[model samples]
Target: MSVSNPTLITFVIYIAAMVLIGFMAYRSTNNLSDYILGGRSLGSVVTALSAGASDMSGWLLMGLPGAIYMSGLSESWIAIGLIIGAYLNWLFVAGRLRVQTEHNGDALTLPDYFSSRFEDKSGLLRIISAVVILVFFTIYCASGIVAGARLFESTFGMSYETALWAGAAATIAYTFVGGFLAVSWTDTVQATLMIFALLLTPIIVLLATGGVDTTFLAIEAQDPSNFDMLKNTTFIGIISLMGWGLGYFGQPHILARFMAADSVKSIANARRISMTWMILCLGGTVAVGFFGIAYFSANPDLAGPVTENHERVFIELAKILFNPWIAGVLLSAILAAVMSTLSCQLLVCSSALTEDFYKTFLRKTASQVELVWVGRAMVLLVALVAIALASNPENRVLGLVSYAWAGFGAAFGPVVLISVIWKDMTRNGALAGILVGAITVIVWKHFEVLGLYEIIPGFIFASLAIYIVSKLGAPTAGMLSRFAAAEADFRLNK
Candidate 1:
C-alpha cells in the first residue's frame, strides 16, 4: 500500500505545523539574544532536544539509513560512538562552556566568546575564527540542503532542483523571522516527531515481516557480508566513520546551545535526555535500514537501485505499512532532521558575520538594529551560496558532511575542551589547533585517508598540534591561578 490520500494529508499537516511553530516562536523573540539564544533561558528539555536534533540531521536521515541498508548491523557501531561522544560532551563541555561564556560577558556567538575568553583584544582571533566558521558552515548547510532536496525528490515527485529552492526558502522563512529561538523551539517539536517516526516505522516492518530472527536470516541469505561489520570497511573507514563522533566538540551551532543555557546544573539533566534520544532515534534508524533489506527482499519491488541507496529505507517502510497519509506525516521527520540542522547552521553562519566580524571591526558604532539587518543579509548570502552548491544533485550528502564534520571536530573540539579547563592554554595554541585541525581534515580528505575516520585522525593531529605548540610556546604562568580564582569569585557572587 503505497502512500495514499491519508498520507498526503499527514505530510501537509506536518509541514504546516513546522511553519506554524516557527511563527509562534517568533512571537517570543524580542531582540538578537532572544532571536539567537531563546533569551538564554531554555530549560533542559528544549536544550537536549535541540542539541540532539541539530546534531543528527542529514547523517541520520540519509547517511545512517544508507549505511544500515548497505552494511547491516556493523553500522550500529557508529551509533554507539555518536551516543557516547554526545553524552561526554554534555557532561564535560556543556556545563563549563555555558557558565564561562555567560560569566565572561553576554557575547552570543562562539567566536565572540572565544575572542573574549582568550583576551584577543585586537579582535584578530574573533575575526579569524568567524571566517573559518563561515567557510565550514557554508559547506555544512549545503549538505543539509542537499538532504532536504533528496527527501523531497525521493518521497515526493518534486524535481531535486525545485525541491532545493523550495526547501531553502521555507527554512529561510522560519529561520530569518524566528532566529535561534524559533530554530531551537521548533527543533524540539521536530525532534519529538523524528523520534516517533524512527521508533514506529521499523517496529511495524519487523512485525509485518515475521520477526528479528527472520529478518536477520533473510539479510544473511542475500549476502553474508550483510552480517559482516568489517566487510569492505577499513581501519581508516572505521576510524573515519566513528571519528564522526568527534565532531561534537567544536560544533559552533550545537555548542552555542551550551553557551545560552539557563544554568550549568541543567547540563546534567540535558545530557541524560540528549543521550537517550540520540541512542533511541539513531538505533531505530539503523534498525529500519537493516530491516528494510529483508522487507523489500520478500517483496522485490520495494528494492530499487542498489549501491546502498538505502537512504530511502524510511520512505519505503512508510509506504509499505501505512496509508499514504501516515507515510506523509512520518516522512516529514527526515525533513525535520535536514531543516532543523540547516536552520541552526544558517543562523550561526550569519551571526559569525554580523556579530563577530562586522560589529567587531567595520562598525564598532553599528546599532543593534543595523547589525540585526546585517545578520539578515548574511543569511541570504549564505542561503544563496549553499543552494548553488546543492543544485548539482550529484553531491553525496554523507561525504560532504564527513569532510566538514571532521574539520570542525579536529579544529575546534580540542581547543574548546582545553580552554574551559586549562588556563595555561594560550591563544596561540588555540589558533594553531584550529588551523591544524581544519587543514588536516581538508588535506587528509583530498590527499590521504585516515585509518578509521577522518575526524578521529584530524582530532589526534589537531590535539597534538595544540599540546606541542603550547608546551613549546607558553602562556602567562600566573594566568591559571587567576582563572581559578575568577571562577571561584563568580561562583561566590552568584
Candidate 2:
C-alpha cells in the first residue's frame, strides 16, 4: 500500500508543533523544579487535559477498542473501573498530594516525597522507590513505543524496526529539550485531538451503518453472545476487569499531574474537566470498537485487519470510512495518544533518576543547570531501554500496559493513600509496603498464580504489609509530630 501524502503531511505538521512547544518550554525553564514540575504553574485546563492525555495513552485509541471488539461489553468493565478509580483518585488524592508534596520537604519526586514524609535518614525509601519507578516505567514506556510502532506500521507500511525508532524519536527529542512544560503543553493539544478523533469516528460510523438499531443488529447477527456482558465470564474475570480502576491511584505519571497543578484549588476544576473528558472519550472509544464489530460483520472482505490484530480495528475503520485527508487526521490522533503518554513516562523516569537518584546520591552539590541536563540525558537513556523492549513487533499494547499498571498500582497505591490520610503510618510500614507490593506484583506475574489480575493480589498484600509492619515497628516521635502537623495543615488549607 502506498503512503497517503495528506496523512503524512498532517503528521509532520503535528510533530513539528510539538517540537516547537518543546523549544519554548526549554527557553522558560531555569531550574530543576521548572524542568521537572513546570514550576507548579499549570492551571485547571492544562492540568486536566495533560493528566487525561498522559493517563489514557494509546490504550484509549487502540487497546480499549481492541478489547471491546474481541470481547464485547464484558471488556467494558475496565472502562467503568477506570472511570470510578480516576474520579476517586482526583477527589481524594489530588488536593492532598498537591499540598503535601510542596509542604513535605519540598519533595520533587514520589520517592523524594516518601523519604521526606517519613523522615527516612538512611535514604532507603528513595533508593527502593526509585528502583521500582525505573523498572516499571521502562516496561510502561515500552508499551507506548509499541503502540506508536503499530501506528507507523499500519499507516506508513514501514518495517517494524524503522517504525519503532521513528515513533520514539520525536517523543525523546521534545521531552529531552522541554522537560515537564513541553510534555504538559503537548498533552493538552493531544488530548483535544484524541477526543475529537474519538467523537467523530463513531458518529460517522453510525451514519454510514444506518443507525444505532442496525448497528446493534449487525453485531448481534455476527455472534449473539457478543451482546452479553457476562458471556462465559467468571467472577474472577469481572473482578480482574474492574481491578484496572485501582491502578489509577498509584500511577506515577498521573500523580505527577497532581503535583504539578498550580494550587489545590485548581485541582477541583481540573477534576471536573478531566472527568467529563474521560467519560465522553471512553464512550467514544467503546463506540469505535462496537462500530467496528458492526462494520466488519456487514463487510467481511475488510475484516483482515480485525482478524489479524484486533487492536487495528480503529486504524482500519479510520482508513476505510474516511478520505485520505480526514483519515490522516484520525490516524494522527493515535500518534498523539502514543506520544502524549510516552513523553510523560519518560519525564517521570528522568525525574526519578535526577531528583531521587542523581542529585540525592551522586551529586548533592550539582547546579540547577547541571541537574536539568542530567535529567535530559536520563530521558534519552530511558527511551533507549524502552525501545529495546518494544523492538518485538508482536508485543501487544494492552498486555504490556496492564503489567506496568499493576506494578505501580500494587506497589504505591495503598502507601500513597494511607500516608496522606493516616498520621500513625510508620516509615518501617511504608518501606515494608513498597517491598511487598513490588515483590507481589513480580511474583504474581511470574507464576501466573491466581488467574486474577496481579494488581488485586499485589495491592491486598501490600496494604496488609504496611498495616502489619507498622503495628510491629517503632515510630519516631518527631515523625509522628510532623505527620500530625502536615495532616492538619492540609485539612486547614483545603
Candidate 3:
C-alpha cells in the first residue's frame, strides 16, 4: 500500500489543475448570479456532464462497486433504480424546471424558486426548504468527505485524520474560490475522468481474468448465488432498491445544472448526453464489482483490503491491475468523483445560505461582489461542518448518502414535480407536502419501519399530502396565471 512517486505526482497535478480551474471560474463570477448559477450560461455538453458527475459522486466508484463486490448482482438494483429515476427526472422535470425557475423571478436556488413559485409572502416555504437543504446536504457533503478520506487513506497509507482533511482541502479550496462555474467546469473534467476510469478498469479486469466466460466461471465457482439477482433479496427489498429512482426529482445539485443551462432547448440534448454517460458509467461500475469477484478469486492474496472494506474494491483493483503511473490516473478518478459531487454540494449549500437567507433577510441590498464573497465564505463554513461530521472513520459512504438522499427525495420530490406540472397546487399544499415528506423520512428512518426504504413512504405520503391539500385549497389567480405562462414557455421551448 505504499504510495509511489508517480502516483503522488499525478495526485498533485490533478489537484492543482482543479484549483486552477477554480481560479479561472473566479474571473467569470463578477455577480451573485454567476457565482451561484454560472450566470445561466452553460452549454449542453457541460451541463450534461456536470449534472451526471455531480449526481453520481464517489458512490459510483466506491460505494456501488463495493456493494456489488460483496453481495453480487442484487446490489445492481440501486443502479437500475437510479438510471430509471434520472431519466424520468430529465424527461419530466428538467426542461420544465429550467423555464419555471426563470419565469419565477430568475431564482438562483431551490428555496428561492419555491418562494417565488408559490408567492409565499410569509417566507415559510423558503425557510423550511433551505433548512431541509442545509440539514440533508451537510450529511450528503459528509459522505463525499468520507469517500475522499478513504481514497487518500488507502492510496497513500495516510492516517485517517490526515487523510480526512487532505481529501477535503482541494475541493473546499476550489469551491471557495471559483463558486458555481468552477464546480461545473471542473465537473466536466471530472466526469470525463470518471467515465474513462470506470470503463477502462472493468475491461482490463475482464481481460486479466481471461475474458467474459472465465470471469463468470470464476464468479460462479466462488459463489453460485452470486449469479442470482434475486438470491438474497425479498419483495420489499427489491422495491426498496428501486425506490432510489424516486429521489432524482428532488436533488438540488442535479436540478441546479438544469437551471444553469443556457436555454431550455439545450436541455433536450443535455438529457440525451447525460443519460448516455450515466448508463455507461453505471454499467462499468457494476462490471468492476462483478468482474472483481473473478479477479480476486484467482488472486486471493491481493484481496485483503477489499475484504476488510468492500468499498475499497475499486481502489484495490485499480492499484493491482494497472502500472503505478496508469494507476495514479485511475485512482485520481476516485478523487474526481469525490470532488465533483462535493464541490456542487458545497456550492448548493452556499447558495442556500447566501441567497435564501443572508441576502433575503439580512442584506436585501447587498452588492454583487459582497454576496459573491459571502457565498465563498459560506462554502468554507459548510465544508468545515462536513469535515467535522466526517471525523468518524467508520461511516459508510452509501449509508450516509442513502439517508440524505431519502431526506431530500421525500421532502421535495413531490412538491417539485407537482408544482411544475399542476397549476392547482397551492402554497399551503406545497408546505404540507414538504413537512409530510421530510417528517415521514425522518420518522421512518428512525424506526426502520417495515424495513422499507424511507423514501418510498416519504414520496407516497408527500404526493398524497400535496394532492389532498391542494384539493382543499385553490391556487390564487396570480398563481394560476404564472403557471400558465411558465407552461407555455416550457411547451414552446420543448
Per-residue CA lDDT of model 3 for 17-126, tens digit only, reads 99999999988999999999999999999999999999999999999999999999998899999999999999999999999999889999999999998899999999
Cα-lDDT of candidate 3 = 0.95
Per lDDT, the best of the predicted structures is: 3
Q: What are the per-residue Cα lDDT tens digits for candidate 2 across 336-383?
A: 999999999999999999999899889999999999999999999999
Please list all clashing residue pairs in model 3, or write none if there are none.
none
Candidate 1, superposed: residue stretches over 4 Å from native: 1-5, 305-308, 450-452, 473-482, 485-494
Decide which is better by TM-score, 1 or 3: 3
Can you tell me which runs of candidate 3 are displaced by over 4 Å?
Answer: none
Q: What's the lDDT for candidate 1?
A: 0.79
On residues 1-494, what C-alpha lDDT tens digit does candidate 1 reach at each position? 22356765776676677777778877786666776677799888999999989888877867888878877877777887787678778866887787677755666987877776677778777877888898889999999998888777776668888779866777887888778888898889889989998999889899878898888888888887887888877775665566667789899889988877787667788888988898889878888888887888888865764334666677667766876667777888888888889999999998988888787778989876677678778888999999988888888888778777877888899988888777777777888888888888777777665345657767888888878887776666444554675466445532
- Global lDDT of each candidate: 0.79, 0.92, 0.95
For all candidates, what are the clash counts? 15, 0, 0
